[model samples]
Target chain A: MFFIGWLVIIKNQKGKSWIKLVESKEIIEIFFHGRGGQTAITASQLLAEMAYEKGFIDTIAIPIIGAERRGAPIMAFTKISEKKQIRTYDSVKEPDYMIIFDTSLLDIPRIKDTIKEGVIIIANSPIPIDTTDFPDNVKIYIVDATGICIKREFMHSSGPILNIPMLGAFGKVTGYYDLEIMEKVLKKEFGEKKVEKNMIVATDAYESVKEV
Target chain B: MSKARKDFTQEQETKIIKGNVSAAYAAKSARVQVIGAYPITPQTTVVEKLSEFVDSGSMPGTQYIKVESEHSAMASMVGASMTGTRTFTATSGQGLFYMNEMLHWATGTRLPIVTAIASRGPAPPWNIWADFTDVISQRDTGWMCSFCATHQEIYDEILMSYKVCEDYEILLPKFVAYGGFILSHTSKPVIIEDQEAVDNYLPPLPDEKGWPHIFMDPERPMMFGNLIMPSGFYSEFRLKIHDAHMKAKEKIKNAAKEFEKSFGRNYGNGLTQQYKMNDAEVGMLIYGDLALQMEEAVDLVREEGYKVGMVKLRYFRPFPVEDIINIAKSVKVLGVMDRATAFGSPTGGPVSSEVKTAIEGVEKTAKILPMIGGLGGREVTLEQQTEQLKILIKMNETGDAPGDLFHGTLWHGKLEVE
Candidate 1:
């Protein structure tokens, strides 16, 4: 009887640890691939802020540091979790979601090879991507963020400020955050004067984003 | 120099800010009188935020001096600190190396100046990444050095530092350091305490008498750090500085207790924080940002039925010898992990070497494993930490060291080179 009770205790302990692991493993790891001055790094931070505002308990945005020039490919990451604190500072190697600011970057082997099976890709392109080369379980979504940025005249010196629209389409695709949380975080970060134009691009991308 | 006493009656607010910004907020909350500014990557944002605070008139009557070099930054801070006002500055990597000259001056003069260091790796390879070698290299500079593992600690430690440094018995400058980019760039939610609470906790700003020993009054004027003959009190002054640092251990513990009483946060006796060590046969001793992550590793390892625990060495200067010996008694195997190198030293790692020296004369049963990793901002993942704990457990059970023991140290996480 004592051995049977001990086995039951060990089973209960194992069950609890397994549940804790699973709950902590629900963290959403996202990778952003963009050219320099495309606002991808800022988008990583803004996404963490948005998720936190939307009630995620823990979030971290990591921007890769390097000597980046205009049009040079750069990468950033955001890890958002609801329960556990994000402890690791390493870059996301197996991202659950990938965001591409420029569709042409898809040609880069380094960026292309990172998209694995069961991963979702959100691209800022006018039309859908040709996913014939991608794995069967991979899903790709496209939104004309540049068109929306131009329509709303939301641009900086280099190019369209694609972070808001990209983040908007991301919110639509993942349902992790919504328009309300975006507006709340944007108003806090970018101030009231710039919120109108930002929301214009953000809403357009939200409504137009479609899975290919 | 004569300005009204600012009534900082604002309510405390919690913000999700980067660790560098948290350092800026701590300075602002302390109402520091003089700030020496120089910009360097990672450490740049800290001075930038403080400049914003000064420019917006939010921090009234604060003199923000723009310096051309890190040397001038520390020199100007020394000038201001001599005038009996609270002074603060920050630097990183090459900038810290540049300020090494004044680092000695601040301690020799015995001013209670507080400087935050977003620690980065030494160069020659031109890298600006998280490594503690920049600050640890200054171990002989006579400044009390403390490592912070969390964003909130970055703020709280600075506040407590001023409290301990300004004590009449312990008028010593201190460096509060954290991993560059790891803590400096990462954003986390931190609670900024109300100004009233801070004012009650910290000692009042120094007056015309300046420090207890030195005075900067022009009328009763005096020259400081003047030329001392070799046969003079130079050695005596050095011995005095050493003595003060040795006595600061008690003052730090008292300040930490008072801070917890006032701010309601515990820092584990202000020297070392133990996690899950109640019934552990093996444990790891680490510091800086890695220590926080090690807590998660300890929890995961304990769930696997291994009695694994961790101890975070907070203060490196005072060495925490008593705490080290006490913690050494609890576990059979202890791993001393350093994120900085002390190349050519006994253990090749600064903290582990110190730990070995700390336990030399003590009667202890624990076998010490000296380990080093995360240099030059190398990534130390949670999975790797779990595996490290398993290695410690294996070594304890088998009475054999793990593989890749280079010169009596396990340099974990090195890339496979042909």
Candidate 2:
């Protein structure tokens, strides 16, 4: 039973406890932008599982599905809350964080325009992004998630499996979870055989990710 | 910490799973004997995962059937159901439309078949996205159609549907519907109950004796579903289907109550669940994925010190007329929101029209603001839902209607094509 053990905030009202819990703190919304083959959607889900495993009261992973081809740009969002149930399934607009799987996605206007003031950006790039057009006071962390995946031999059929390392970098950047939490979730999702390789790439990005 | 171990027989497992996966797990938990499947967008993964479960020998007791089309998929389910086995299948949008005739065949034969619907918009702009037009279009088919507001509810409701649908008093087919991509594709934390807990909650799987309703054995051979003339039991049978739907309301509520007692999840009497409606003067009646968001919308609206509430319409076929009427009477104004369209209907939205019909002659009824939006997987934000509640409050304060009322219904969130 997910969150059944977490009955810390019990509201004995005529309305009930779930609604009362959902009305607590503002939810932490993270948006992920990636091309179709890149596994941004899985990154979103994995991030949710990791956060929830690390004791976030509630979380949801929403992927915007479309007629996507291999190279077509796709989007997903993960909303995790510290003390509240995530009732809304809407895609994040004014996101607290953005995970960019490719640097070239910023060239697309729709993706670029969502970079709001004071938002933190974690992009999978080997170098600092051109931030001449980025909003003021925005924090950006750059990780060579692709580079780490290749070095660790985390090659899926399409390319490097980007989500595992990307989420590993995310855990380090946000401090919402750690490599241990990622290990627990990855072992659960990918199982023991696949978890070793996945964690190898994950630890690479976890140790190497830095603010630009 | 080791919660996601491969073994599933003992302890309950909680995992972040797609809604389609939840439905598939529900079928596995229910010990469904047969699956008739045809792949469609948004619904493909459900049958795909069920096939995986069957192929991997995890569900060795189950039989998986791959059919060419949605019609054959349901036709196979009807045939399987006749043999008195717990049968399941899933389809969406055009696939549901293709299975229309068999949908009636499943219900009219009084089979306890359960189908998961990743509801999508009807085709011809050739759309395959979230919309309830497909399931609601099966209104006359006599299947008990229910909507799920959360990912967990998709699993809970399917298990509950079996209890209600398999009841001798209401041996009817059912559709557990949710928004296609909005729910079906999205992943969320869902609690997968252990086999022991599920078996304890649900009725025992029919023994080798087959289902008692229509047990087909070589020793006890009997013909079923023979053609009936106009003067025959045709009219009686039709009346009995309607009678069972009316009775299903109570059975659904009981199942929800027992589920809460057994599994500790509350679904507000199963037909319609309410949030903060007791002290509210205005409320919103909604269903499917949007209703979960509206709870947040209601909480946000309540933070501003306005009396607002919400009700998620859980079951559509039973209609839950008494509950709808009670909700209407308790509020000063009620907004009926629909994520599916109903062209030429009185309210221009399916559920809103039903709400109107439900309270037609009710005394001192609340003003109903009929609304339709979020169709074809359109994004209806929390702010938009909060705005709709504000519109209802304003409608209560001042007797003026909002602008751009097509046939006196609000067609909200349409793009401005200048």
Pairs in steric clash, model 1: none
Candidate 1 residues lying further than 4 Å off, grouped into runs, are A1-24, B1-9
Lowest summed lDDT window (length 10), candidate 2 chain B: B1-10
The TM-score values for the models, in the order shown, are 0.94, 0.94
Q: Which ten residues in a row have the lowest lDDT in candidate 1 chain A?
A: A1-10
lDDT of 1 by residue, B266-298 (tens): 999999999988899999999999999899888
Per residue, candidate 2 scores C-alpha lDDT tens digits across A1-212 of 12332212322212243232333235888999999899999899999999999998889999999899997999999999888788998888778899999989999988899898878999999999999888899999999999988887888889989998889888998899999999999888878998888888888999999998
| Displacement of the residue B90 alpha carbon in candidate 1, Å | 0.7
- Candidate fnat values, all: 0.33, 0.75
Candidate-wise lDDT, in order = 0.88, 0.88
Candidates 1 onward: DockQ, in order:
0.29, 0.40
